[model samples]
Target: MGSSYQLQQQAIDAEIRSLEGSIRALKLRRNTFAPISSLPNEVIAIIFSFLRARVTLFAIKPGKKPDGLAWLRVAHVCHQWREIALNQPHFWSHVDFTAVSSAGAAEILSRAKTVPLHLEVGAPVGLWDDARFGPFQKELQDRVPHICRLAISAEPFHLHRILKGLIMPAPTLEFLSLASENDHRGGAAFVPDSLFDGSTPRLSSLELWNCDISWMSPLLGSLKHLEIRSPFKWPSLSVWLDALDQMPQLKTLALHRASPVAPWGLIPSEVERAVTLPSLTHFEVSSPARYCGFALAHLILPALTSLCVVAESSRRDYSDVQEILTFVSRHAHGPQDSRPLQSVLVRSNGMGVEIVAWTSPDVHVELSEQISVSDARHSGRVSFSITNSDDWSPRVDTGTLSAVMEALPLDGLVTFTAQNRFNRQFWLWHAPKWPLLRHVRLTPAAERGFREMLMEDNKRRGGPLLPLLKTLVLVDVALLERRNLRLCDALTKRVEQGVPLETLDLRKCLATGHAIELLSKIVVDVLAPEKTYETGSDLVSEAGARLIYVEDEYSEVEDYDEDDADTGSDDEVQDMDGDTSSDIYGEGEAVYW
Candidate 1:
């Protein structure tokens, strides 16, 4: 009888717990349906806009249901939310019929009403069946007037076929980017002449890739940004100038692999007058050397802030560089002829040299030479190198550098770099010309010549070569010789005299531990080579003084390949493991090559 009573007591306890849970659930349900749930439709719509989904609508293929979307989530929240969402036409203005069924497309269009649309439409690659795009094309044709932005990427043939006889009613269109997709035949498509019927008055941005469009098209008058890539044939210089004259408001222009009507070797007997692009601020041209040369010579841009010139073939000509200097000389003048250029970056490879300026990197220039310039975001750097030939003279480089120095205002220059084969003696002689320079980076060969200048400055006892230099970075500088030691002593004396020599980075240097430690005692921060060597501070100097020992190790020689370096192009850079390149310079540090 006692055991039966215990089991009955446990059953009563279980029943009490179940009743408590039921009461808590009832309270939660009551809170969910409180009076605050009756929000105004306008308030609900504003909130929904904040939570609206941004997706590539064209990525949704036909017959596939899009699950877990923001609009769907809101509609399923409650009956009130469902009613509000279904009634708001703007909520469904962005339609992707490519992924949904015909019935779904119809409902979306009906709900969107007459609101402006941003359409991403095209028959995806490999869908040769015209039946697949019947419903999609019909909807696009009907909604042509409402599309403000159109981005289409499809085969040229298919694109032409879709809009052959259809008149585009795109009066409100502002931006249009059309590109050929997977055209293995090198994008030789003849664009229809009457495609837009001379419409698109409001089109300000136009980009055409691998499609031939007449330069005389009246529809191109209002374009502000223009890019033509892989044209079927090069237009004559006169024709190019005529087309440019029409687009007076063009701000940015880019031409890639665009041929010229004139053949390479024959110069036109009649020279076309240069076009004055008062509004153009950024320009880029990549073509054969002759074509690039002619274009640079004939274009006059008083407002050009950024420029990129890519010579596809290897042939050293100073006229192109001279033309660039002349163009800069014309624009780089204030009322009193103040130098407008703040910085000039010049880089060279085995083939040739590339010279650029630091107004902005709105323009990307690629050349056969491995010269490059980054935008304002990253530090602007230019690297120059030449073939290691004894007979190769620096005359060409001398003229180039002289032209650059004359064209730029060096009063604002803070950082400078003279790297491999950069006419070291020439730079050393001219080092004192710029007084405000603070940071300097030099390679092993360049540093050798720089040591002489430092010694000359030390002898003066007052003026220094770089008086304001605080941090020094030297690449592949080995302090194994007596002369190198004296140079270090001179630098140490400069630091002792309150020049603020805070950091000394001796990258890939060959030096004894005692030598490094002795140098470290003089300088605040010393980055010696990471090498395994004797660690002793008892090395007797030439003056018979013992110095602290520092253990140093040598790392593998870092090789620099021009082709492998980042040219700052739109193309993404990836490593063998699929990782991308990262920024090398940190905040507050100067960028030098």
Candidate 2:
């Protein structure tokens, strides 16, 4: 009986082993018939490339752990995928040193097999002395010759160490980005003069933040896109011109706080002949007004389609502003002169002033948010921004606003959008400047001044202001009884003066039924709520209306009185309008009111 039991146990164990083998064989067979398995190797590699791009983008987000190799997990899905991933040399060529262990780096390098590499290395935060950093530095040193794109962000000391070992030639390199993080803690890191042995023949895009490179470096010769921020030293104006002269093919140039300090008595007349950048289409600069003016005065961008100048000074000087305006006037026309300035957005508040002009008629500009240079570039817009140096100040200097508005080329402007507050007298004086202006969009704070401008224009013996104006959009307004009557009176007067508005769009406005009815009779088309929503009954009281309006008005104004020049009291009944500031700008396309 014991022998029989042993035999049965042995048979059961053998059967179990047999079943496992059969299952393994079935899985292999199943994989063979899978739809993905039928794809060509090249197609599979393409699919992997897409996944790699997406994963790489997410991995680069601030404060996120470096996981450059995370895309390789697809290989672990199955044996077939593993084989495909392993066979593609290009798939292994991108090595982010931070994501790999020393041993893993060696394996990846071996698998890459002489393929040009794209390397990314970021020093670990607060752990620049980590033991693993040594291996990364060594790998970068050994792999410099094969690197095609290298982007590294490190603290100054670590960056110096890594760059010190990269003296070898990088024949295949095309893009290079070196940013020194936490640079404010100490002096900036300087790029070694011997970097790449000055032999990066194919480099086209170069970006450096808190890193300084020689203005005369040979690497500048081939760059098509150049960006430098917070450089350790600003080269002389002549040196900058010489460097730019070497980069004839440069398409995009961004200099943030990187301009040379203007000579004590520097003026536009003192600037030498401008260096012409024939190929440059996008130019952006952020610096003190004087520095920006000095830089622009030295360069001529004939092909420039997008220009963004952010002036960060509060010195009350208009000379720099004049220089910037002159630069804009020179390059205001669109490519090949096919498009001309058609829409203008002007935003002024206590913080500063922003002016955005688009050659395209259909461009919509948001009021409450700042517009970035890149955003303006892609949208074919030109923007000028002046931020108040003192945050506690109630408003930008009145002179600064006047200089910018007076210098604006508004002869052909057809659509005008003004937000926040402007000096009432200033608007009245400049209202007739836009001869071709047809559409006007205003925030509640801006509406009173504009309305008064229209009324003043009607009384003008010469002609009316914004004579071609046809559409009016009032945003975030409160149309109580008195305000309604005033607005209706203004529109009625405009009609009598032969400058009648065609459409009146009230967006996100608190309006009484009677107010909407009165506006409907004046405007050809009045866009407002049909139901009568009383301002003070259960929903909102007169005091409640004041609070609502004041709250929205003060949203952009910090520590400012409600009676400031830009805002009005609630009892006066400011005209009613609706929508967030963004909605007033339209979401997808320009909405002509």
Best by lDDT: 2
lDDT of 2 by residue, 86-150 (tens): 98888888877667677898889889988998888777656756578877888888888898888
lDDT of each: 0.57, 0.72
In Å, residue 202's CA in model 2 sits off its true spot by 0.6
Task: State every prediction's TM-score relative to the real structure.
Answer: 0.63, 0.81
Question: Once superposed on the true structure, which residue ranges of model 2 sit more than 4 Å away at CA?
Answer: 1-21, 31-37, 54-78, 99-109, 183-185, 314-324, 331-336, 348-351, 369-374, 377-380, 390-394, 457-463, 529-545, 551-593
Deviation in angstroms for 379 in model 1? 10
- TM-score for candidate 1, please give it: 0.63
Candidate whose TM-score is highest: 2
